[model samples]
Target: MDTQGIFDSSSTVRDCSTIFALSTLLSSVQIYNLKENVKEDDLQHLQLFTEYGKQLKKDNGKKPFQVLEFVIRDWQYDYDYAYGQSGGEELLAKRLEITEGMATELRELRQHIRSCFERVTCFLMPHPGFEVRKKSFAGEISKLDEEFKTALKELVPSILAPANLTPKLINGGRVTARDLFTYFKTYMTIFNSNTMPPIESIMKATSEAALLAAMQVARELYETRMARVTAGLSLPRPALQQEHVAALQAARAACIDKNKMASTKDVNESLARLTQELEALLPQYLLINDGNLQKALGEAKDAYEASVRRVHGADLLCVHPSDLQTIHNEAVAAALRVFDARRKQYPGIPDDNRTKLLESFLPRLDELNTLNNEHNRLFVADAKLSFMGEVERLLARDPPLGPYEFRNEYNRAKNRAVAAFKRRRNMPSTYYADVYEDDLLRSIENRYYIIREINRNT
Candidate 1:
């Protein structure tokens, strides 16, 4: 009956008539919906109960109705409300609500159990394009998964339908012999779809662990980007400078040139040795910092070449009349600022390694920088570097406008960067413990956590 789920236990004499009316209404709905075959089937079961139940009573020498319907007080687990409009109607409403909620949830779950046969399909089947990060609609997929587990126990008795197909009839039990055949006919439809496997078996056949695997990647990427972007706000360097760049460049050029002249032979020899050391280094352990040291050597080499051509060609080194001019300018260094120019004003000659290569040469590079700074104090005209015109005309142009301001800034920055490189170099080797590599392996270990949780639950 359609009223199969709605049973009232409030046996009030006055309310009995109303209860009968409700029962009839439900029964009529059930009867209206029933197909002819299903009606005939139900009728057959009833007939067997009537005839066989009576025979059992005769054999056992006991009075009996058509069939047994014993009310087991302890076994009665009613989900429906016991309602007959009393002072305790609110309590009835609450119980009914709880029962209906649980059953509704169970029904929803069983639907998922059925649908999983569709979802947990063959591996080769093409997947629908739906993002797992969010539910597709009304949380159908999520609800289905939740329901499947809950429905497992409820489904066990269903297996009996298939087993009942083969039956042994006791004495005079003709209906039982035929009923088993009918039961199997119904069971075959449920069986052919292969939907009856236990949930664990289905999960094993389909490697559904990928669902959690994808979630882990999403979490890590979110954490990484959040860290990098926030870290940019706390950088140690100043925002980049736009002015005084010209003055800083002029001072650097003069410094490089001075070093080029004073230690020409020494620098060339050092460079040749450094290059040889580098070729050996790269083939063995490539980034052993050969690039950093070689870069500094190459800049020194270029400056030496420019100074040599002028000094070698003529016995008169500062040949042009303009060359004899004052060695002071705010924006451009006089030739003397660079001590290297003294030795390297001739081409094809190289520098030798001095016993105090770092001690002597590094001081000279600084001295040249100092000479440029001294010039920044004088308000001399901007001198055109070309060998041209009267000395008076050269001296009369506007002096370095902001030479002191810019070079001080550049010098400070260079000191900081070089200091940072030194600090990094002095640190102890990470290779002692191989910590970074260990951290990477540790990260991969975390990815299998989902499987561990499921195992613990089981």
Candidate 2:
């Protein structure tokens, strides 16, 4: 790979270095083109592999890639050197030894590449048949010399044949095309950001991608199953509840089952998404149920008040002491029945909708009961007034009867007034009734004494 570019030299240098570094990871076979010899300076490009060696060793163990050293113009016959029958590998090694100031660099290059690529095997291009003077473009393959053609024929099949250059393998498993694309894309992003993309980052990106894909699959699976089950229809609370829970469990199981290799975080993220999707189904149910809840509450209130009215009457004067609690109990029971009858229409996931109806209905029921008591108080007040009027009418009689006769008539009148007061009232509690009767008798006694004083004076 070329490591020289025209931009900011340092920036471009790092970019190119990073590119070369990642390229080693992707390639099964790496090639280096040289003009004549493996000079000391030519090894500079290989120096970039220094830091990645440990990472490569960890990933691939001792396995290595094939490296081809393609030396052009080396086969040209001259007075000092001539073509021989020696093997290309032997000739290249001999030439490296002869080159000045190349031994140390070559050894270091070998060591570094060994660490980075494990046991990399270097191949010299096969000897060419004939010499060509000019550089040729790749598009002119047909016009190239027979010697160049022969070299390519030997090189291409050596790497491309059968399992010679297999796809990148990680932990003994071949990487899929999708994984490879993700890797390259990650590397490019890091390269563009002027950062060296570490192997750890690449692995992390791969893991994140797997988790995201798993979450998506789980989400889709859950939605598909639920959609088919519900068919865009708003189901009752019990049916919806059963279906939601089952679908959520199956989706979570699918995510876990399909990606058993996923980490805890990955699995948790996918499960969280499933939960969210399950809850999403509830809004429609809630919307429909909210209306039902209101309707149920209204019905409960009406039922409670209707029962209260049947016993208390519109004036509410008929209520007795025991009627307060008894009426409330019966009303509450009726309200509960109202809610229970419509329970299927409301969402019950969070809480029983019946509770909501009772919460609202009970308070209003109490208020109605209070109104009944207030009206009953008015009834008691009216009875008291009527009793006082009868006593006053007896006192206002003209030409009062003689003392003994007046006493007899007063007793009879008081008895009749007490009976009349009792007849008009419904509250059986006699606490107020006794007090009013005592007041009437005391008033008549005072009148009787006054009549006796007048008779004695005459």
Best by TM-score: 2
Error of 2 at 361 (Å): 46
Once fitted onto the true fold, the runs of candidate 1 whose alpha carbons sit more than 4 angstroms away are 1-290, 311-458
- Model 1 residue 388 CA deviation in Å: 36
Clashes of 2: 1
lDDT scores in order: 0.28, 0.57
TM-score of 1: 0.16
* Tens-digit lDDT track of model 1 for 1-458: 22332223655422432332222211211111111111223222223223333343444433222111111111111233211112123322232233344555434333332221111110011121243334555545443433232332332332235652322222222223233334234333323452343323222221112112212222233334333322312111111111112322333333233222223554344334433433342222222223322333344344433443333233212211122122112112322223332222223333332112234444544454454333322211111111112222322335421435333433343344333322322122323343222332343334324423432343
What TM-scores do the predictions have? 0.16, 0.38
Task: Please list all clashing residue pairs in model 2, or write none if there are none.
Answer: 53-116
